[model samples]
Target: MQTFTSYDGTTIAYRVWEAPADAPTVVLHHGFASSATGNWVVTGVVDALTAAGRRVVAIDARGHGDSQKHHDPAYYGEDAMARDLVGLFDLLGLDRVDLVGYSMGGVVALVTAAAGRRVRRLVVGGIGASAAEQGGVDRNSLVGAALIEALLTDDPSSISDERALGFRMFAEATGADRKSLAAQARASRHTPIGLARIKVPALVLAGVDDWLATRPHVLSSALPDGRCKVLAGDHLTVVRNPEFAAAIVAFLAD
Candidate 1:
């Protein structure tokens, strides 16, 4: 594990594995409430990529995992996380890297790649037209408030929304900081995402049964060089599937 100071002086945590001299490096950013271990390492993504002769870099986003926990909403968001990624590249003197992200991490990668940073390739999953329509799950409004309540409230039964309840249960099971998660919900973006700006080759992946990633073709059509691939499973189970890593290995090998 390694740590770097982000733009706001918040400490960001990451892990890296080296590959052969000629192989490409891949960066993995996890989803909300998931750490690097839970998202990529335990899911067999790191092993798959490393076995394919590719270097891997996985991060534990601020307010999650081993990273700094900031209770302020201002400290968390895709924009901030994107900047942290670009900064990581700069600090490491990396020219470019193949980036992969899931769920909330997907939004961060999209925003970073769209800005024309040092990203060579992109693969974002657990998202779909929501990326084009609502900037990839913009719960910044009432829906976001509900989610915040789900994260902060003392009583679990108070959360009426099934998805919100799921998030709460997942957070508790993971032993995550609920207050920080509430701040993250409070900071959800309300603006639209400019998908057309990303010029690099991109794979907009989604699980066939994922409700959050419906009609991924729309997301693919929106990007300059994007294609959609749907695999078996839903949002939670997709990353654990062997085909998921296989798809990413094949895409980055291109």
Candidate 2:
């Protein structure tokens, strides 16, 4: 695992799967409560990118994966995470990269691209129009509160919301730090992320059955150059789709 110090002195962890030197690098950001391995590597994203002759850099966001974890709510948020991503790019001397981010990472990607950073192309997965219209990641507000409660609660049965409960179960099943994730949940921001500021070609990819990504085109239409495509499954199963990587590879390659 390679490491870089973020702007706030946070230790961010990333892994590089090298391809030919002339190959373009693709940076990947995983979903919330998920690490690079869980979101990209295990799901065959890294392998697909590398096999396609592209150098892949998969980063574990703060409070997730092998990155530094903290329980303070102030330390966690998509804005902060986006800063870390930009910092990594600057630190690594990456002039430009094709970025692919899923779920929470998609929010971070939107924030980064909206800031007019050095992204050549962008692929936002598992996110929809409502998220693009409103503040950063819409953990759904009330749904978000339920998630926080589910993460910190001692009894799983107490979480009545099926989605939030499932999230809690996924976190536990993955052996993630519940406290850090809770802090992340607590820090969910509603600030508007200016997607219109991004001027790069982007692909809005998601599953037809995914609730979080209900109307993919709403997000696509929001961007200057963007389009939407949906696969067969829901949130969890979407990444497993071969077309997921195929679509991303094709989009970034173009």
Candidate 3:
């Protein structure tokens, strides 16, 4: 695992799987409560991309994996993680590359694209337009609070929401930092104002059963060069599907 310092000097963990000289590089951002390895590596995404003749740069977002975990909500924001990505590129002297983001990572990538970063192509998976507006998931809500409580306690009966319970279980099973994830709930909220500003080719991907995500077509229609693709699974299952990586490889390959 390689490390890089972000704008705030927060240490971020990343790994690079190099492809052939002519192959393009693709940076990957995992979803909330997921690490780089858990998202891309274990899901067979890294191997798929690498086999497809593309270099893979997978980053563990702050508070998610081996990276620095800050309990302070001030350390996180809608664009803070995006800034980390930009800083990562700066540190590596990489001017441009293909980018793929899932769930929370998708939000960061969208914000990065809105910032006019040098992303060659973008594949946003497991997220949609609601992330840019107000109707998306709320971290401080009753359900979120319940999830945290479940994660902190041994008694699992208190978590009524199945999704929240699933998250708590995943976090515990993965030994993820619960407090840092709580802070992430407060920090990650995107409010994209100018969709037309992002002129790069983008694929807005979602699962057919992912009701958690907002309308993917809306997001695609808003962007200057955006299109929608739906996979066959829900939010949690979609990332693990080989089709997810296949869609990304196809889009970036073009």
When superposed on Cα atoms, how far off is each prediction in RMSD? 1.6, 1.2, 2.2
lDDT (tens digit, per residue) of candidate 3 on 1-254 = 99988889799999998878464579999988889998898889888888888878989999989999999989886578888999888877778879899888887887787786689898988876675454234333325556656656677777777777888888887889988888887665735546677799999889888866657888788789999998888878888888898998889988
**What 10-residue stretch in candidate 3 is worst by lDDT?**
133-142
Q: Spell out the clash pairs found in candidate 2.
A: none
TM-scores for the candidates: 0.96, 0.97, 0.92
Ranking by TM-score: 2, 1, 3
Cα lDDT tens digits for candidate 1, 118-185? 78899999888878888866342227767888999999988998888888999998899999988887
Off by over 4 Å in 2: 21-23
Give the alpha carbon lDDT tens digit for every residue of 116-168 in model 2.
66899999998897667766565563377788888999999888989888889
With candidate 2 superimposed using the best TM-score fit, by how many Å does residue 152's alpha carbon deviate from the native?
0.5
Candidate 2's TM-score? 0.97
Best by TM-score: 2
| Local distance difference test values of all predictions, in order | 0.87, 0.87, 0.81
Off by over 4 Å in 3: 135-154
Error of 3 at 245 (Å): 0.8
